[model samples]
Target: MVKEVNSQELSQILSNDKGRVVVDFYSTECPPCEALAPLLIELESLYSNDFSVYKINRQDNRELALELNVRSSPTLLFFDKSHEAGTRLSGTITVQQLIGAVVDAFQVEARTLIVPDAHENIWDVLILGAGPAGLAAAVYTARAGKKTLVLKGKAKSHLELAHLVENYPGLPPLSGKELLQNMETQAQGFGATIEMGDALDLTFGHDMKLVTTRTNVYKAKTIILAMGKGQHQQTIENEERLIGLGVSYCATCDGAFYRGKKVVVYGNDEEAMDDALMLKQLDCDVSFVSYCKSTQCSETLHESAKKKGIVYYPDARVTSLSGQATLESITIETEAGTKTLEAEAVFIIQSVPSKSLLRKTGINVESKDCIAIDKELRTNLPGIFAAGDITCGGLQVAVAVGEGVSSALSALKYLRQNS
Candidate 1:
């Protein structure tokens, strides 16, 4: 069990001059911190003797948090013999990442606590998204008695954000939230499980498809792509070439790799702001490049960032990325003039098309980055279907629902024949 410690107790523990220590500075009402709690509990259960684990409420212990430079919730600090050890991990972290941090901090090997094989939970139909297309597909598949599962990403669906949805059939005009709630209710009533998490990676076998998230893995006999459009893809030079080399879309997944390095984040959403704060906690030279107007960001975030002394570039856009083999600098177009900023890494967070997931499965996508699907909503790969905005179908809710039903029928047929 992880013990809750105040600043005084924490300072005393850190200065004990014995035993490896792991301190977690967390906050209430923080989703990422909530998600990290279970993993931390499991870690303590597995390595109680190797290290001592403690938790501190950042909100209650403001002075200690400031002194320790814990600017983000769920900031983890490792210590060895009264000295800091290893790099701190902030934001959402996977089990593998946690283990790696422990090894780096204490030189202790993980004997147990292995991640269960993703292939363990093999559903008849595994939907890659939980948008209109995915939820619609689940309604059909679950009614047909096929084990259906939908992986809902952290990013809210475009439809969910819409203020009103007027044209969905068999329903009166209602708010987007209401329409989605009805769909979710219908899907769940039919015995479908809608799990919330992002699909971090996907792999295909001859008969099975494997999907990985930060905390869990899933398997499906048939897969459906209803992930909607990609809105994050910016048309910057050398962006594609530097994907793993430097350019990243997820700060939580890649921020640790650039500890104490120069990094630039381009976006105006909550996720982008959170990423910027996380990088700052890791001692990275962080800069915020907001494409939105100055008033767009929340006052809390804007003020907190300013207080942290993070550089801000409002109303700016990245025009190009320059590097030989890896990213070296980024050129931004601001109101003042075009300027190049020296950056070791660039993180662009936005919504774009879901083309990369399609490409990974060897599925063909059109020139406009839309997945190609037949009238039946089936892709080139057997037992795999595409629907919703991802297929370049009309962006209307009614159209996505129709395509979702069609794809579900096609998937049902494929499953019956294979069985």
Candidate 2:
């Protein structure tokens, strides 16, 4: 029921008062945009008398997009009385977010309105990530005869960026795209359904976990956290600019490449200690730096490092990572004095930021961004489990796969126990 409009048509549509106008500014080859189309159609179908839905291809209307300051795909702009009204929404959008905008724009009490229940069932297990971890989980869940759905996020997997991947066992050197394709096909062969979209909002305060995507409000019996690394509280200096240079998050993923080189592990937690040890095992000259004055790092881990002859600066904090094109050295502040450590790589392992959505949902988190889970991959929530980079677990494809399988098994067990 949504109308496709050019900028000229949109201008006229906006001039007349037809309640409130919901304009979707979208671009092609945009996953989130594709995910949003159905929802817009459904909204139009339900509330044609309340508001009108219109779509504009941003590519065909670059001038209009720029004029509106529309920088991202799937941006929803609400207009009333030939003027912009209410806040603008971009990226992944849910029916809740969309409908709320209408209610706010029109103030439903201003007139009689019919609202539709947005929640839809009934997926048994909903995996949030479509990377190696998510795909691996789907294989297990589907093979167990459980109805599993994996969401391929709007962010492309790093695998797709990888030109060549040789570490995966039994596989000859192949492109990451091919490897990912193979994994998807295998999981689908087992009857697992893979969806492409980003989760707009999540509701977990009740027994049935509700995940809202661009298309539907999903009701799932169990959920898995396989989304890639959580967003950091703040960007680190020169960090994003030097991602593949000398800065890294997952040691195991990039450790082997740095063997025999100097590397510093900057963290105060067990995960950080684990990275330091893993690097040491790979023959990297490892330096452990703690942001805290002393250390909550286990004495056992400290002693193990000492036994391995790995150096430590428990009271030091990284001040800067310097290198033009590649990482060259690390600067730190210590109780003794400011010092610089020569290093090829710096593995900065920090907790997931507290502002993460998972925290908003009251999921137990060990630190900033990463989810907390037991060995069995069970989250504090009864029907939720976590795996892969989301858990800050090694961050390697193999590690994600292993955790995905573990999470799937845990989900299956939870379902059976309850049934």
Candidate 3:
């Protein structure tokens, strides 16, 4: 069992304990923390004799959290014999990632307590993203009597953000949200399972694909890519080249790496402000750079930054990143003049397409940075298909729906021939 401890108790326990230790810093009303609670219980039950698991409430142990440089919820730290061990994991994490961390830190082989069999967890078709294309594919695949599942990404669909959609056949002018709702209901009526989650990693076997989320793993015989246009990639010079060196996309996942270091957060969304606040708590000098005008930013974020004493730059744009091998400083263009700030790290938060996953799985992409598909909507990889905006087709609801249907039919044919 995982025992809850306060700051005072934790200090004593860490100094005296000589066994393997894992402490979880979590918060109330955090969705990621809630998802991790059950996983921690499972881990404790399996490794109770080998290691002791403990939990600290960030709300109650704010001082301890500051000292430890833990800035985000659901942060996991590993220690062996009172000394830090292994790489720290934050944000949404997979079961495989947690187990790998334990094995690396303790040098012990870890196994899952409950193992699911192939027949129990495998689906006939698994679709990523819940946009118009994905939902349409689900309708076709499920109607063909195949078990279909759709994993809706955390990012909202571009179509859903539209206030009105004027041109579509067989229906009156309707709101984008209304059309999307109708499609979703149609897919569900045909017996498709839709779940909301983000895909963290993808692994492929000879005939199967594995998609790992923070809270669960999904296996399928065939897969479809219908994720919409990639999120805005950073336009600053050397930004892409410095991805893992000193540049990060997910602040919650990499905040600990820059503890106590000066960092710049370039975003205009709520997530960016949350990262700035978290970094401030870790005693790091943080600057909030909004690409939009000051009045355009969320009032709540603006007020929160003011109360926290974080430096704010309104209507600023990152022009370039400097440093040979790693990021050292950034040049920003403002209304007054160009200014360069010394920063050890930079965080650019935005939702991008799922192209990274495709690259990892050895799928071929076209010149336009999209998955290449044939007339039948089949990708170069067998049992895999591409559809919608991910294929670089015209950005229209009707086009996406047509591509989804074609891809589903091709997938059904492939399965039948192989069977």
Candidate 4:
């Protein structure tokens, strides 16, 4: 059994610890945390002498959560010799991943090594984003009998920020988060290994491409540059000053923290409507501010917002985002006059540009912002491919799905030809 510790006892325990320890900092309420708890207990029973597993309630220890800069719940911390030095797994993790982390953290041979197996150096496909497009690609690739790995970038997927997506086919008016959950589960169900991390840098050579994240480096024979645009930063006073304070891009990830609070969605695009609806679900007084001339939100989204009494401020440009230490309010420039709206959080949606990883790697982008590609979806770089918003197609879920399927087939053909 893993010993549960609180902040009051953490200092004392760390002071007396002799060997390796794994601190599972988790909240009882989170589903992913709950999913991991039993596995962790089993690991504790399996490695009693080599390591000790301890649980810390994040809610109980505000001081500890702050000290460790705990961003999300159910985070796992591995302390080799002392609690002061450690590595952490935030959000969700798998048994295999956790085992690998333990092996690396404790410098012990993984239990799996007991069985000798042939090392097959084959990663049939490597998709670099987890948005709808990337997820779609993984599903198709894995279904095609290829070993696939998906490296999820930040934004998780721009599709995820959307709150209500009535336009996505088959799924009847689902929240963006729920829709993304289905996509993720589908990809996972098809034997596609989804790794939660970012591909910080990408490089292509004659034979293979290398993607380096902060945690690890992955090599692939063929690469899909599905990493869509990193959100454009809102250049407002104190906006940069108060990033984690209240300003957030991910509603599902952070909406619960600001329950019943006032939040503003900045943008006139479909994603803005989606985010506004998510905030509304948290019982927050939601408002949508659009700088765009016309709001492109669907009828379902507009009706939903209207029924919820969420306000819409069109032709409004946020001149400044201000707060003392956290977000306080946003100043908007309108045709009438400059006005201020008090808000605890601001969701900047217009920053969703298309060029990202492909740009950095020198893949040709056209004037219309589509990645220059043939019908095959292969970029100028021979082994590098692109799909979804990264291409010149309109940013819609249906288009992304079709592009993803096309890209996967094209990549498979490329791999087979070279192999």
Candidate 5:
């Protein structure tokens, strides 16, 4: 069983424990801490006789947390007798990583990888976005017998929202939705795998690239950036200054940090609603502020919120975020008027900011903020390419598809040469 310990109690247990022990330094308003709670409990059950699990609330015991150098919530420190042992883990802890840590700490039980094996395999081509350009690139690469994976974001693609598209050469006047479906079908038919998750982070390298999503990590030989311009650009005031201090883009990643504390969810998408609900489960005082109307969201989401008694401030936008050492509150401008919300954290749930992601990969961009791509649609960096509106090319579907093909061929060439 998992035991909640104070500073003195934790010290006593650690000093007396003959076997291995794992200490989880958690905070009250921390979603990561909440996420780790059940996992640690399960681990306790798995090694009932070999190890012990103890969780101490860092907020309630600040000196102990500081002494342990626990700068973040959900920090797992393994102990052998009274001395700290093994590697410590903090932030966005994965099951596979946790399992490895357990083996290193306790060497207890023969463990199997909990997630699918495919997530660990390297891909020949990895495409970002599920729009026409990305799908077209996937179709080409997958048809060329290259292992391909495409990740789509929570926000519907700009192409997916079109009412009708008729300018293309072949097909009749079809809905944008239908055209996109056909493209996805073609890519899948060519053996390309498509999954739904925003590209949260990108790590570029000489031979391989690492892309982290909400759930999985993927490695690829070549990366295709076809997400186009993002709808969210981190516009709120003081948002950047307080990134780690309080304002977070990912709910599941940072929600545990705000567990049982007042926080606000800002966005009009279904993802925002889903995150707000998750916060409620963490016992957070969650208030949702949708940029659109109450009627704009699904009835199911509305009903769910009503049932949960979660307050909603529709047709609202946060003008600014305010805090010093940590986030304190947010200023919202609703249809009614301006109001201030006392919040420990604010979750901006939207598509991952493309510009920010691009900057991290060191991709060159012109003054137009469009990617600098060669005629072959290859970016300045090797093994990286851009397509569609992101390249500041023609916005039409045909132009996007043509660029997509060009980029795919370039990526295939890069892979062949590298291999």
Candidate 6:
């Protein structure tokens, strides 16, 4: 007969056993649990002596279920030991997927893979943020068979500020949201659990780091902080008065309504090019006014602007804004002297890196306010890693994604040594 064990007994069973085991926290009333029952028995018969299977009914084993934090029925976990479970599947899982998971778990040594489940605490690595960096980390970590979770907030990302981003690799002229969503969807497809919420604070322990949010705290052996730069605002005198009315920072979010109208881009870097490219695509008469003498713009951007008939003005600095109630026009000091440019909306795209959170953690930073990290994306702290625009260079989405992936792999190696 199969063992009917409580949480304490199950804990003891794992601690004492050297052989592999499968435990299912289930309920008879749950249709999904009932559906998975036959599959569990099949796995037991298929693996034979190499594998052991156990079942804990949720109704009769309430304490065990509670202790393991099993909220839903039909949760299957492959047990390697008391302290570790290799594969965990919550909710209804397909028979083929369950078989694949079991095969992967028992064949760990042969396959050279050690993928962590959603419920497992002993992961090789955990990445923060679900943006380009975090999502990239998730893909690499999961494919490497390491446990990975991406903390994605419900709010939109900074990348979604552009109506159409033309410079990202592979796809050409894709909407920012569409591109970000594609990355997020691909990460989820690879078994990474994308949790929605912000990481409020972080603390480091002996072998693991703790991520505290408004709801719960998660422990990871290694962490990658891939949260990108924060939004930058212009400090023009009276600009704050007309916020949401005409003065805007996000062109993609508020650009469509101002179609065929005159708008001004108050930036001098690649971000300005990204913003102006989107506005120009919206059929809006977009003009680029730079605080810097020459713009460091993309080749496609320069060509696209010319093709779309967008105006470009170099060495134009905004001294102040003018309007009674709403935004009317901006007064600028150009090389030809002071000039007032009539516009309905102004988009601010400052290239300043936001590293206030990292600064609070005492991570060493560069003169440009980006966090300093080695080639492997390791910060001064042993278990902490940084990626994306928050780190040394590479402000592009693709580069940030590559950085996050490499950092996660390095973090996994670090975790394996300590764990």
| Model 6 per-residue lDDT tens digits across residues 1-419 | 34567677777788898878888887643444543554566656666667788887665676666677664455777866544455677544544456667777776322222222225364456676677888888888877777778887533566777688888877889887888888888887888878865554454443445554434556677888876775343457677676545775545435554567789888766656777887787688888886665344534445655776777667677778778866788888887998888888887654212342343344687876677899888988887888887685667777888898788878878867766
Cα lDDT of model 5 by residue, 1-419, tens digit = 69989999998988888878899998754544554565677677767788888999877887888788776676899999778887998754545567778788777764542222233588999999889999999999999999999998876777888899989888899999999999999999999999998876665655556677767667788999999764467778888787757787778767776668999998786777888999999899999888866574745566667888678887788999888988999999987899999999988877767765565466898876799999999998889999997888988889889999999999999998988
The clash numbers for all candidates, in the given order, read 10, 5, 2, 2, 11, 1
State the weakest 10-residue window (summed lDDT) of model 6: 109-118
Model 1 regions more than 4 Å off = 1-120, 153-167, 172-177, 213-216, 292-298, 306-309, 334-337, 416-419
Off by over 4 Å in 5: 1-119, 170-174, 292-299, 306-309, 324-326
Assess candidate 5 and give its TM-score to the true structure: 0.70
Q: Residue-wise lDDT of candidate 2 within 1-419, one digit each (tens)?
A: 78899988887888766568889998764445664676677777777677788999886787787788775566899888768888887655544566677778766533222222335556789999888889999999999999999987656666667799889888899998998899899999999999875564455522456665534556677999888764344355676666646776556445655657899998776667887887887788999887655444546557767887888786777877889868898888888998999998988665333233453355788764678899999988788899988888997778888999999999999999965
lDDT of 4 by residue, 1-419 (tens): 77888887876667778788888877643444654665677788777779888888775785777787765556787876675443566544545567777887887776631111114344778898888788898998888888899987545577888888999877799887888788889999999999866554454543555565534556577887676654454466666566557765445445555667898887666656877887787789988877767445444456666877888776778888888867889898888999999998887654323343343355788975667888899988877789888785768878888888889999889888987
Clashes counted in candidate 6 amount to 1
Model 3 per-residue lDDT tens digits across residues 1-419: 67999998888889999999999998764444654665678788888778888999886687898799876667899989999899887655556667888999888787863422355678888998788999999999999999999998767777898788889898988998999999999999999999976665565443556666545667788888888774464578988777656776656655665668899998887768988998898688999888866575646667878999888887889999998877899999988989999998888765533654455466789887788999999987888898898888988999999999999999899889866
Between the candidate structures 1 and 2, which one is better when assessed by lDDT?
A: 1
Q: Estimate each model's TM-score.
A: 0.63, 0.46, 0.63, 0.47, 0.70, 0.43
Q: Provide the clash count, candidate 2.
A: 5
lDDT of 1 by residue, 33-99 (tens): 6556666887888998899899998868878987987766678999999899998986555465678
Residue pairs in steric clash, candidate 4?
A: 163-274, 370-392
List where candidate 3 sits over 4 angstroms from the true fold: 1-124, 142-149, 152-167, 191-200, 207-221, 280-283, 292-297, 307-309, 335-337, 353-357, 412-419
Better of 4 and 6 by TM-score: 4
In angstroms, what RMSD does candidate 4 have relative to the true structure?
Answer: 11.5
lDDT of 4: 0.71
